[model samples]
Every structure is written in structure tokens, then in C-alpha cells.
Target: MWNSQSIVQQQQRLAHVLAIVQDLKALSMLPLLTNLDLIQEIQTISTATRPFIPSPTNGLSLSTELF
Candidate 1:
């Protein structure tokens, strides 16, 4: 009685093996995920914010610095 189901013994085992392979495939992308996160964190940290302060133009000039 070597039917297909009997040969495989249990379909659950096959399903489990497929699920484990899928998990391994996902683990293969771990480095890519970490790289993207590191890049985003670096960009966030290195951002420089300059406050908007109006330059004084009310009689003070750059020529005065030479004197």
C-alpha cells in the first residue's frame, strides 16, 4: 500500500519544511534591513539645522570689517 500519502508519511512535515525554508529566506534579508536602518539613523543624526536669523543690514556693512 505505497500510496502518495503513505510515502510522504505526513503532509504536516512537508508543510513544516516549507515554512522553515521561508523563514530562512527572510533571514537572508537581515543584513539589508540593518543597512537601511543604519543609513536612516546616520542621515537623521548628521542633519544640520541652521536657525533663521536675519542679517543686520541697518547701517552695518562688510566694508567696516576692513577698517
Candidate 2:
């Protein structure tokens, strides 16, 4: 049974981890040998943090078109 305060703290930590992962991705700083490991970590963290985030109120999908 998790309390609200603990949930908020966990969400914050997950958000921080996600930020670091995004920075690493943007800088291309990871070694080839660890790229797969990093990708797995990113997916794990994203899944963990998804519940704390709210969906868009406007009913628009988060995905965007490149074309």
C-alpha cells in the first residue's frame, strides 16, 4: 500500500531518470555495447512513469505526423 506522498516521490525520481536517458540519447554518448541496455532501461522507466502522467484533455493523440 503506497501513500500519495511516496507515489509523488517515485514519480519525480522516474521523471529524473527519463530526463537523463533523453539527454544521453540526444548526445549520442552511449557506447555501442551498451546501446541495447540503455534502450531497455528507457522502455522500463517509460512504462513505470506512464501511470503518473495524465492524458491530454483535448483528445488529441500524442503522436505526430512527419509527412
- Which one wins on lDDT? 2
- The backbone clash count of each candidate, in order, is 0, 0
Each model's TM-score, in the order given?
Answer: 0.40, 0.41
Where does candidate 1 clash, by residue pair? none
lDDT of 1 at 38: 60
> Against the hidden true structure, what lDDT does model 2 obtain?
0.65
Candidate 2 local lDDT, 1-67, one digit each (tens): 9999999999999999999999989668656538668756665666564422324785322333233
- What is the per-residue lDDT of model 1 for residues 1-67, given as tens digits with 9 covering 90 to 100? 5789775766778889999999999778767767668655444544433222224865221222221
Stretches of candidate 1 exceeding 4 Å from the true structure: 3-9, 35-67
